[model samples]
Target chain A: AQRVTQPEKLLSVFKGAPVELKCNYSYSGSPELFWYVQYSRQRLQLLLRHISRESIKGFTADLNKGETSFHLKKPFAQEEDSAMYYCALMHDYKLSFGAGTTVTVRA
Target chain B: GAGVSQSPSNKVTEKGKDVELRCDPISGHTALYWYRQSLGQGLEFLIYFQGNSAPDKSGLPSDRFSAERTGGSVSTLTIQRTQQEDSAVYLCASSYNTGQPQHFGDGTRLSIL
Candidate 1:
């Protein structure tokens, strides 16, 4: 079965500092990874996908087959960057999500 | 365009009572999904509906949980004899088709007292 693991439950970073949310998955087949974000009082939205290889809101994630990881990263975290982030693995037409990481960008 | 919409943004029901959560997928979206968001469990896939195909109930936790999508647009998840453990945010999402990015709803926070 495919599974996603987000090691960090919570992360606190100063404004303008770098923030990295670690995500690792286990899947026998080729994996499709995605990062979803949910802001306070907002619906969960797609942040980025590995297949696109394009950064969204200054966040980018690279899928590493060797490491089985697809960690999301942002060079300079901003106040609005605080949100709950989830790493998901898509397989068999469904998604398996991680426990998620709550990031807080403190000013 | 409007995103996926879920009704009863918040629901409070007593244990042993039945509750139904509604999900209205984005117009023109043929793939709809149901998920449960617990305190620390992230999002757990509950079911999937694609067009007129049979729904996938493999992710459902128990017999008390069931879902149905009518006319391939609106979906309703029914939980019979709800338990406290069922108290969580029920989320619904929809996509254009397979392998497409899913647009999520605001979610309905179900609280069982």
Candidate 2:
């Protein structure tokens, strides 16, 4: 079985400050990690995947095999970046998601 | 449709009543999935349908939960004798194929009275 854990339930930051949403996972086989975001009144959407190794909306996540972590980071937070973020692990086409973290960016 | 579509954005029903939720996957997508999101359980996979093959129902919480996809496009999830614990946001998602990134719907909020 695979599991994803997000230690933080909520994170608050001032505009222009750096932010990080931590995520950890436990899986026996190779793991595929992804970050998904849900904006207010909007559907959940894929933010980025570990395989892609690309940044989206100034956010990036690095998959660390030794630590079994895939933490999402943004260099500078923006008001528009406030949203609920979920970390997920895929195994056999089924995704196991973390409890999620709500991010608030204050002006 | 352009993206995954789910019907009945919100539903409130008696505990013993049966309820059905619908999901319309993106056109040409071969993989569809159903998940339940609750305050305590986060997101739990319920079932998955790939093309016309037998669905993977291993994630279903109980026998009272069942789902079916017809013509490999639209899927319906039926809960029999719904219980208060069944109240949650049921979400539907689709991908072009297994291991592909999924696109999700707004989800249907089921409230059991």
Candidate 3:
């Protein structure tokens, strides 16, 4: 069975402060990892994928195979960054999602 | 192109009643999936239809839940004799194929009263 775990249910940081949303997964095969964000009243959209190794909105996540982790990071947080972030694991046709971290960027 | 679209943005029904939620996939998407987002919970896989192949229904919570994809374009998830426990936002997503990024609809918020 494939599982994604986001240990934090909520993370708060002051504006301009660094933030990290930790995610870990357990999958036997080479894994595909993604971080998805849902802003208030908006559709869930892909933020970044580990395979792409690209940054979106100043956020990037590096998959660490040794640790079995893919943690999203940003040097600075913006007030608009307050949203629900979900970490997902792709398996076959299904993607198992974490419980999600509600990030609050306080000004 | 437009993303996945789900019908009846919000539905409130009494317990024991049956409810049907609809999904319209992207124009060229060959894979459609149904997921449930319960209050304060993560997305739960419900079912997936890929191309013309049989759907994977292993994620279904119980026999009370059933879904069908017609003509490889639209789908409807039916919950028989619904209970308050069935309350959740029913999300529909579609992808070009398996392992591809999925586009989701705003979802149908079903409140079983």
Q: Which is the leading candidate under DockQ?
A: 2
Tens-place lDDT per residue, model 1, A1-107, is 78899999999999999999999999999999999999999999999999999989999999999999999999999999999999999997798999989999999
Which residue pairs show collisions in model 3? none
lDDT of 2: 0.96
Off by over 4 Å in 2: none
DockQ of each: 0.88, 0.94, 0.82
Best by TM-score: 2
TM-score of each: 0.97, 0.99, 0.97
Interface RMSD of 3: 0.9
lDDT for residue A96 in candidate 1, whole number 0-100: 90
Lowest lDDT 10-residue stretch of candidate 1 chain A: A92-101
Candidate 2 C-alpha error for residue B106, in Å: 0.8
Error of 3 at B54 (Å): 0.5
Instruction: Tell me what TM-score chain A of model 3 achieves.
Output: 0.98
RMSD of each: 1.0, 0.6, 1.1
Candidates' chain B TM-scores in the order shown: 0.97, 0.98, 0.96
